[model samples]
Target: MTSTESSSRPYGAFPVRIGFQVQPQHAEYGQIRRAVAAAEEAGVDIVFNWDHFYPLSGEPEGLHFECWTMLGAWAEATERVEIGALVSCNSYRNPELLADMARTVDHISNGRLILGIGSGWFEKDYQEYGYEFGTAGGRLDILAEALPRIEQRLSKLNPQPTRNIPVLIGGGGEKKTLKLVAKHATIWHGFGDAETVAHKHAVLDQHCADVGRDPGEIERSVAVSDSPEKVGQGLLDVGTRLFTVSASGPDYDLGLLREWISWRDEQNK
Candidate 1:
């Protein structure tokens, strides 16, 4: 590998991996469970479900499942791929409690867990559940405070996490979010085209420098739903090694995921 190639490996020696987020909305629980099975059987590296009380898109009054409980079920059902919420809102559960939930799932999955978390959004979820729908900045502040407490609680939990339980922080905020990524995240989930991703990555690098962290220590990840041949290469050139493709339910299609998985294998070879 060239010097640039060596530095771009997100998890040191690990190769590029693909993830599928099965949106648990507008579908039966059985359909969602089958989707999880299909995703892992199709070779997806990580399988995620969003953390929300209701559907994010389509019908407002559609069926949706709670995030953590579904994850608990995934732990027992799937045998290979890691599982977690795509981005669990910090405001919904106490940070300490969330940490314990993650730990328990990690044990259940025999260490195949990634704690993907972010500041709360979606005002409807807050209003309906009676959670304070604070300003964006305020929620980010709470997340900033909560991250450490979660880590601290993880340390004190009985038996501890099975493998340090990698932290995947999702968001593209150039200020607080990226800074948090620099300080704590093992993986950073982001969105945008290649130019936008490169710019955000540059900003993330600056944060890492400011905090005296080696920028290469953080893995770059991006979400994509189409045209991996066009965008995936651009992202890889700029250091993104994890490509997460989102799939909604009713028919959580694995066609795109299979394409990305094939694409990942071709690139790694």
Candidate 2:
């Protein structure tokens, strides 16, 4: 690993940040709304929801809500923490329309929006929604094409975003996905343990160089489980700074969020 790509990816210097993904499945909208409030109160740096038409766990056809609309509500409901989908699948909405929605939510939240997007999976969502469930490679190609257009639309919006609304691209495909992250994303989110993330980081850095981007410019995020001690330390040591945990709704429990918040404070201190 090159020096820039190896151990120096804004990990130690960038203060650790915690996120809570309020999974919008199997719950009342009120329950999801309240959880966002509680997460912000508990000192999470960001609040997120996943983009799916139905429940990812528990009941397959469980009650669920739309992603962008819920984000608009969260923008109005929460005051401090940033809000967005854990990743809004690119295949679901037109790129330009998605950009405008993100811009609107950015204003609603006074610039607290992170446009987390990905080359969507979840065949059921595509199948039922009447979208062509093409090959993964084709989907990724579509995402690659959409990203630049999203940026263009964001620039041309009526009132413009409150800030240059941060773009977060979620995926770990070393070739295409990381390249997109280098080209557009302010944040890059991936799944895995410390070892897996470490390898991804190294690959991402190479992509950054290939694209002539500074490797440290993008924030590294990971979806996590258990305590900061069990899963966080290894990730942190390997250069991940933004750690996100998910809460399944109905009654959104924030106990783990509290623990992660405490750990974040300790690390930042």
Against the true structure, what is each candidate's TM-score?
0.95, 0.96
Give the alpha carbon lDDT tens digit for every residue of 85-117 in model 1.
Answer: 889999999999999999999999999999999
Q: Could you tell me which residue pairs clash in candidate 1?
A: none
Q: Which residue runs does candidate 1 get wrong by more than 4 Å?
A: 1-14
TM-score of 1: 0.95
Query: For candidate 2, lDDT tens digit of each residue in 1-269?
Result: 34355355454466789999999999998888888888888899999999999898898999899999999988888889999998999999999999999999999999999999999999999989999989999999999999989999988999999898888999999888988999998899999998899999889888888889887788899998888879877888888889998989788889888999999999877
Give the clash count for each candidate.
Answer: 0, 0
Worst 10 residues of 1 by lDDT: 5-14
What's the CA error at residue 263 for candidate 1, in Å?
A: 0.6
Q: Evaluate all candidate structures by whole-model CA lDDT and list the values in order.
A: 0.90, 0.89
